[model samples]
Target: MNDLPAFLLRKADEYNAPSFIPADPICVPHSFSKKQDIEIAGFFAAIFAWGNRTTIIGKTKELMALMGNSPHNFILHHKEKERERLLGFKHRTFTATDLLWFVQVLQQHYQRYDSLETAFFPTPVKAQEHAVKHGLIRLQQTFFSTPGAPMRTRKHLSSPERNSGCKRLNMFLRWMVRHDNSGVDFGLWKNIAPADLIMPIDLHVARVAKRFGLMERKLPDWQAAEELTAYFRTIDPEDPVRFDFALFGLGVLEKF
Candidate 1:
């Protein structure tokens, strides 16, 4: 695995795994010892999570100000010393749903730590309202929430599209964990094993995994995720997602 180019591998891993930055506002610590600090950091992360670290280059300030003015949107203590780096919209890319989804999270957090002081929060259950509001979450007819709901997948499916979804979701999760983009303080919730996790099947990851013989099914879809995950389960049932890096690395480094 290390045979792949270091920088390329790093980029692949950067996109594949969670690198929780400290400045991210959504990275709720497992222990709420310093809750406010963690939540603020988590916020910073989710904001930049849309694509990559480079994607959300400098959008912290705008979000911070939005938090300040939108009382219902954000909660921060007046007395707390804020990070100056988080002062302005260094480079903002706005989507109404993104802001709305963020506030919904705050509404839940406030139920406990009434003040805007930083507090650790775990990944809250994804609400349908937020999905519909921001129109980000995917809606597939076959994607029901029932236990082991079946989704459609033809055998001919290939990479890029099939595995791309996981890329997006994983990127989002990374944003959910860090305070900044640097992984300086790994969040408390970093041990999450992505069992029964949905595959964000984009063409890139799927084609790559298939080329490495990790996936037998040519079609990349929900069934593909399940089939591939079953094989990985045997390798390390406790945390099968580890294969994602190896598989993704194959594609990024063009090893396959």
Candidate 2:
């Protein structure tokens, strides 16, 4: 237990290989080249990234197909008739209505910005505490800022204001921000720093964190994410979320 961070670091190195990308929702973004395409694909994939991993990957691929496998182009220029393909799409609580609102809001957002990072971090990403969490809240405010956005769509996005862990958005930020030789994370964003990123606390990560004595919180809420990230930051403040691969692989793959 004393050497837990070292062991987790080893596991992170072991599991963060290029080979791990194919079976992951991250693959949806890796399939594309353009930055906008990667960002768009990764955003939708992260939103659908709950429940069974296999099912998540499958449904995400279906979503890409609906966008004609060109997410940025589809979001910007798809004709009204083409949106019919998004009908009947369902993944857990994310229904067709939710998807439709996302498309519309994203389309509206892209009208002014070239990437989701700009939409999320409209202001300069200062080195303030809870900057990432504040950005998530701002993203929600901006997403629903315009008219015609369904109230239900707001439920799909999480915010620190609601005390949500915001696992999906944090994970999406990891995909966009964390840069490493490891081929898993896309590292496409330049605004947000990896140091400011929060942990994406789900059941698996929570279980591993508690077992390793890294987390004391009873529930995987926003507070737990902060506590866990704080611990990891003590060890590696500049790139704490890389421990995500270790916790995920240990919990889901190795049963640690």
Candidate 3:
């Protein structure tokens, strides 16, 4: 409707090419075929998707190797001796303790639900705004509810209720939920509508959004993610988060 929307659409098209997948953490999940493997790999990759991109990919590969490149199987049935291989793994502040706890939680979760989506949105979806926010809250609760979960590991799994931007989790959601002819996104989860997805507002995206008059918030928090996603919806109600590539690309690649 507006020039801003059109311009962003153009940028999204420019950036959302098939070739972009290889350089991203999403590639880790893409390399796997099984649904559970994809979910497990993507979740691990996303949680560690901070700091440098090269470092992120490297660590993700290392972690995957430790899992024997079979993430779901590894998480569900890792022997005690096999888990010792993960003892020295560390990505930023996410250390071996956090990784082991995640495996434990995933085991508990898979025992109950068929997919991770159910663990997040266990209740029926009512007609409501911020249902995704509610899902994230429930997911946090479920994650920490695992037996012997250390309070220290809670920071890795963000809570939107706490005003966190939750950039990485939202990015993982994008990888799982948004599909296009371009094939960058997976569109694996059918329960969550694409319209409900929010922008993963990292620093690069936030800077680009501000430069384009898409956001006024100084902090890239939950409020900023909502504001930015609402603005993007005006441009494309069916898939507002498509513009996430545009925002992130404009900032990171074009240096806008």
Candidate 4:
């Protein structure tokens, strides 16, 4: 276990580079320079990141193109009549209905707040240890706060309350909150510290973590995600989730 930190650091440094962006869903947000555009694009990319990487990137870019490649402007000012262009959009189970609802909620949110980071905070009080967990719960609440939100869309947004791993949302938060000169993760948001961010666990991450003895949970639920992250914190308390690049690279790229 003593060698684990050096190993992870090497893999993280290897994968957390500009070259890693083009072939991954992170490329969607990398396409934009503006903060709002990155947040909006990154959110969609993360939400659509379940299947093949190629398909995920392709669908994200398609959606961006449909929005005239200015997602922030299109989300805030585009008329209802103009939304007809989005009517036929579909990425797996994320149908046009779900997409429209997302747009509506985002439009409402950006109207009052300049950044999507505000949605995660929800309240003024500081939550030190469980910030990401609480933030995700609040985000889901705000996401479905609007009347006529589709029941089906709930599956798209996972939360710790439901014992979900919340892989997508956590990944989105990592992109916005984790600071580094890697030129990969955006690190645009400052309210949530990098230490508070939870590890974004998927099957690949779970398998790798368990093999490393960093995790012991059989099921990749919210508890397992938290457990894995706890172990990672021991290795690098301030930037534990940075190991995500290492685990992901090992599992998906190196096939470790």
Best by lDDT: 4
Clashes (backbone N, CA, C under 3 Å), per candidate, total 56, 0, 0, 0
Worst 10 residues of 2 by lDDT: 118-127
Off by over 4 Å in 4: 122-127
Where in model 2 is the C-alpha error above 4 Å? none
What are the Cα lDDT values of the candidates?
A: 0.41, 0.89, 0.86, 0.91
| Rank by lDDT (best first) | 4, 2, 3, 1
* Candidate 4 accuracy as TM-score: 0.97
**Pairs of residues at least 3 apart in sequence or in different chains that clash in candidate 3:** none
- 215, model 3: CA deviation in Å? 1.1
- In angstroms, the error of model 4 at 82 is 0.8
Off by over 4 Å in 1: 1-53, 57-94, 112-167, 170-187, 190-201, 216-220, 253-256
lDDT of 3 by residue, 137-240 (tens): 98898888766888889999998989998999899888887888998888888777788888999999999888877789999999999999998888798898
lDDT of 2 by residue, 1-256 (tens): 7787798889888988998898889988899999999999899889999988889889999999989898999999988899999998999989999998899888988888888898777666767888898889889988888887898888889898999999999999999999999879988887778999998999999998888888888889999999999988988989999999999999888888
List model 1 lDDT by residue over 102-177, tens digit each. 3434554575554332232223334222221122222121123334432232111122234423344443333333
After TM-score superposition, the amount by which residue 26's alpha carbon in candidate 3 deviates from its true location, in angstroms, is 0.9
Per-candidate TM-scores read: 0.45, 0.97, 0.96, 0.97
Error of model 2, residue 53, in angstroms: 1.0
Model 4 sits at a Cα RMSD from the real structure of 1.3
